[model samples]
Target chain A: MTMTRIEVSKTYKLFINGAFPRTESGRSWPITGKAGDTFAHLCLASRKDLRDAIEAARAAQPKWQAATAYNRGQILYRMAEMMEGKRDELAQAISAVPNGPLAPARTKSAKRPASRTSSLRLSVSPSLSPAAEVSAAIDRLVYYAGWCDKYAQVLGCHNPVAGPYYNFTVPEATGVVAAVAPDQLPLLGLISLLAPALVPGNSTVVIASNTNPVPAAVLGEVFATSDLPAGVVNILTGKRDELLPHLAPHRDIDAIFAAGLSASEAQMLREGVAENLKRVQIHDVAAIAAGEQGQSLEHIRGGVEFKTIWHPALA
Target chain B: MTWRSPTVDTVMVGERAASFTKRSIKNATKRELLTLALSMLDLTTLEGKDSPEKVRGLCHKAMRPFERDEQMLGVRLPSCGAVCVYPSLVPTCVEALGTSRKVNIASVATGFPSGQYPLEIRLQDVRDAVNAGADEIDMVISRGQFLAGKFDEVAEEIRAVKRACQREDGSYAHLKVILETGELETLDNVRLASDIAIQAMDDVTPSGTGDGNIDFIKTSTGKVQPAATMAVTLVMLESIRDWYLKTGKLVGMKPAGGIRSAKQAVHYLVMVHEVMGPLHAGPGGSNPWLTPHYFRFGASTLCNDILRQLVRLKTGKYVAGYDFSEA
Candidate 1:
């Protein structure tokens, strides 16, 4: 008798409108491991994918903004819970790339002795381990989750006027947001940019790290299992350079939050901002990796618009 | 006269209809298709909360779909085929459209969406709209009666409403019979209902005499789920083709509701061109059904989407929904 065994490989697909779908363009790129063997394939999202993701984000923005602040907080907390449950899976995906930007910090320290010349030239900052990165991502989600219902109060204020009128300014969700995840610290950088935009009730279409997108793809799974509404958080796994040109000039996207973009990419985004007057916020990779600056209230403020209302005051 | 409608081949029809969507229409031809689709729209507002201002806004949109057309696109778009509304709003449409007559006024009558009302009352509804200056009457067929196999009663009611579409001046308003195909349940039923509507309208006024304004057989009332699927529309177009071939009498087609994108509109046009023929007389004789005089799309949201695509073609930039007027 002859027996055959087969390995069931995972097919990483794009998360669009709350469902997993292959790229409409029918294109895929291989993800290689440290041994230079193709371990998985990721969908190479096209302009059409960016269009669809923006459409989904626009459609979901109104309802997501309409949801009570408390409910939004609860959903964010639920996302954190889901992330906590998927901690082991996320760490494993991150650790798969031993020399990639998302590799655990200790791996680089362990490999330091073998390449003394390279180590001498390279400045190495202490980064989190895979397990620690996952934990920080979860904590970052909870941090923003707690800020959801309270950020508006802290950001909005009443203005004292000389006339018999009451003026008040309040921050509202800036509609659909497009985010570019950092190539370094893929999971935490993505969550850091994503959580702030989400805290203001803005629906997001995030382009995951091009080189190491598996961790972000796994985060999409966590998002699906959580109570977040479909289209509210669409994740596209593709090259940021290919998608940013389309994302910048998109008329429907109200704001863009990108991290670790090259000078040319950042310049292209800033130029495209002139098309629709959409706000573009670019952050340094070091700032995002610092965790302190990335998780601040000012980051949350980047994805909202201030609407000042004037009402007649009665004596 | 008694009529026997042909049964539709469901599988073949589905395959044929799906093939039309696979055609890749590009650049100049795509722009032309988008412009033609813009001309074929029936910008409609059929809500109970509809106001005179709303009807006027719809008429404005129907007349000039894109206000910046000349400046941005460098060509003025053709006005939409008509502005469809409830019977009560016909006078407002007449007032808004004025005497330019660029856009026709189409009113939904005969207890629209559900023709369950009494026949006499439904006929009066038709008369009221035509008298108030509606150029077209979109009357709903008695679906309940048609389903109960009272085909004669349904046909008679349609004939009565077509007659009611006549004004004192002896000019007849083109009648569109809505079969509400979503409730019809099968492609065979859709074909039969299309035949019944075409024959009933022709009994009052003979079609295909090059009159340009022929009667139509529409697919849905825009209130039902699964309104105007391609398979259902194809069956109705086939009914029209067979009628034209047999008696040289042409009937129009309108697939309202659920058609909201420019890409889908292009597919419908492809299906129409292949199943019916060319738009006008050239080397080959014209397929009259391809013209706005014979084809229409009853949609409110479809207008902005077509405009978005047209702008994308001209300016090379994708536009937002809010960039267009909400009406």
Candidate 2:
């Protein structure tokens, strides 16, 4: 059922299980992104958002599981279709990567994809326009969407069980993942998490990129408009250290994802995910900066639920 | 207080700018850190990180004598909210300091000073620090890949570290990721790192990654000669404040390394005061963040001078420096 919108100075609803609630910590912040041209008032997810995420995970599990796996695949394909239709209007959602001075070098180097690793890339460009970044992001997301049907087949391997269990493991989506997006690529990176998981039948909760949360929030409008399921995605654009623990080791969550974490930060997730055997994938900046594999690795390891069935032939 | 020396150009901002600035920020030129203390141009938080066990030991030797009501140094500020030390020594420090005053312990992880280690080992170290009772944790990123422009790997590593600190408090330990500004190589890189840290701090997918993660925007590890300096401090403060004003969520700041004297510590305080303003941090030691609750100097020898100055003021006569160890 559709719910009535609550009155407030700004909207930073806790994107829990699949609904929006104010953070119990009752904190908020202003986000300045988009070439320093806009401000998107955001709410720091308090303990409440974490709780809400857990509750949402619990509520959505049965439906997600009950949906036929084939049907789930179809929905993702549908999302891609919708994205294609709205690419013109949702230019920011599917922003294309820029073709700058480095473009020539990258164009030439595009032939070699294996030489990359983890490290930080700190480049500031006052010239980077909001429109340009968003365009690049849209292109990036569209690329991931195309990979939805193909990646699992290409990346996942067939499992050979000892018994006649009919066991062949297709790469499954990590369920109800909680992710913290990078500060700069608000639209692009957050979309990276959403499309990958939703395409695979898993829902996700994202802490919007602090600086560029405006576009992520804008993307939420797109999600709501796209016939996306109620619990398919939730976003809490708030403080990482504060909101994450609530989501970490949450009885309902199966995995945890953080962007640009330190050793200490990486350790926290490793430990939190260990409690429930939730898969934890930490990004290696050097490898990523080198760009051999983006967040898709984390998407695979973030956490997936597998069903093992048995049969007897006594009939 | 015309405190200067032949080896360094501590305070570049002179009397003219000082008039516009404030006296609380004097002697800030050492690393050019005072810029953080002079204005509300950035969102800054005080940072005190303790790694080598030796540093925490020094804090105790210096702090205990003054706690008892007998004859001691006349310094007034309480020990920093948290005494940062290596994870291995947290239990010892916590017990030694006693539970009377809440002094938190901060530990460094992920092959600090040089980010060279397997991802598994890095997380293991942080977990070990939390197990050892570290109230806060500091970590360094892999500079090698970063310098090579591996943004994704950098973003992912920071994200993983934050995930490891899970406890009933939601944070097994407060996490602070160090960017080591000296290595980032440029104002643009520093700004980008700041952007990443701030986002990571807030748990967002930032343009640059690291939003405000790990807790503090630390400048550098002491091992790097110049350490966490003022240029980075200015840049970090500017980034944090820029995010804060736009978001309304307060982020913290910490400039570590190359800090050797109380006067230098005071300059950092002055810089923090000037940049983010008093609203930036809560009560010093009263808050649970630990030594340098809002601001900290990662020093190994600040005790002696603090004592000498206090004695000089209280006795009304110049006193010779004494061996604090034997005392």
Listed models, DockQ each:
0.64, 0.00
Residue-wise lDDT of candidate 2 within A175-220, one digit each (tens)? 5666666554555556555555555557677777654455555555
lDDT of 1 by residue, B47-68 (tens): 9899999999999999989899
Best candidate per TM-score, number?
A: 1
Model 2: DockQ score? 0.00
Q: What is the interface RMSD of candidate 2, in Å?
A: 27.5
**Tens digit of per-residue lDDT, candidate 2, span B251-309:** 56777766554455555555565666734433451321122434455544454445443
Among all candidates shown, the one with the greatest DockQ: 1
- Model 1, runs deviating above 4 Å: A1-5, A98-126, B207-213, B278-284
For candidate 1, give fnat to 2 decimals.
0.67
Pick the lDDT winner: 1
Model 1's TM-score against the true structure: 0.94
